[model samples]
Target: MKIIIGSLNPTKVGAVKKVFNQYKVEGLNVPSNVSNQPLTDQETMQGAINRAYNARIAGESEIGIGLEGGVIIENDRLFLCNWGALVYENEVILASGAKILLPSEFINELRNGTELSVLMEQYTNEKDIRSKEGAVGVFTNGRITRTEIFEHICELLFGQYEFKKRKEENN
Candidate 1:
């Protein structure tokens, strides 16, 4: 089956291709325009929907993916929410990675209006914050690999799709 990932982003491309490869699904990466501003969780989800919906209108594909990030509050702490929206033709599938946990005190500081990227940069103090090919970035220092995190997101998406398919078959 043909799967169209909504963005030409290298990270997203790497993530999707890695996960879908195991399923034997042929995945395609299409160029998509993502907004510059960071999205809220709800807005992030909406962004995914927008991307997938637009992709469907653009052409025929078995699946489409939209990856987005947002900040969410829980127990007075702010967390980084990175997720992917997987659309299977007419059906919409949702999947999310585990939230990158933040310290409560730091979350409070961010809540006071500090950007997480800046905070992360200042905390590391090595510059090039997005670099995941090393011991920096969100998924480094032996914590998590970028590929593994994205794979989790993809797993949730495909797993949900499989669940639905099974449900439908049973009925």
Candidate 2:
């Protein structure tokens, strides 16, 4: 089957590749149509959905995968969140990664309307932290990478798709 991943970001592409290695996969820069730093879980997931649908149509492929990272608030505390989606034919599967709580200082910065990527870049004195180890990797002390976070989500997407197929066939 042909697979397309939405986003030219190396980490997102790498995450999908780890799961769909047996298939013909292509990575294309597709618009998510969401803010660069999505502020809520819903918007983040919407980005993933939009990317997946757009990529599938753009590549004329059987499957499309999208991954997105964002920040969310729970009980007035900001946390890092990521979401992923897989689209196939008339079906779509969605999965989310673990949420890592942000430090209070970063939360304050975000509340002041700074984008997460920009804040992270300044914090680490690094460039393109969003496309690299990511906030998850830094916050997690390099134990879990951005790629691994989305990789697990991609695995969940395929697992859900397979489970749905089996259920339909059995029915």
Candidate number with greatest lDDT: 2
Compared with the true structure, what per-residue lDDT tens digits does model 2 show for residues 39-108? 8999999999999999999999999888989999778788999999999989889999999898767767
Q: How does model 2 fare in lDDT?
A: 0.90
Candidate 2 least-lDDT 10 residues: 103-112
Residue 119, model 2: lDDT of 88
lDDT of 1 by residue, 1-171 (tens): 766666655556677788788543333444335443243567566767666655555547667777665567777766666667877757888876667655555666565666555666777675644334222235446576555666678878878888999999999
| Superposition TM-score, candidate 1 onto the true structure | 0.69
Clash count (model 2, backbone only): 0
Q: After superposition, how far is residue 80 of candidate 1 from its true place, in Å?
A: 0.7
Q: Against the correct fold, how does model 2 do in TM-score? A: 0.94
Listed in order, each prediction's TM-score against the native is 0.69, 0.94
Error of 2 at 100 (Å): 0.8
- Report the CA-based lDDT of candidate 1 relative to the real structure: 0.63
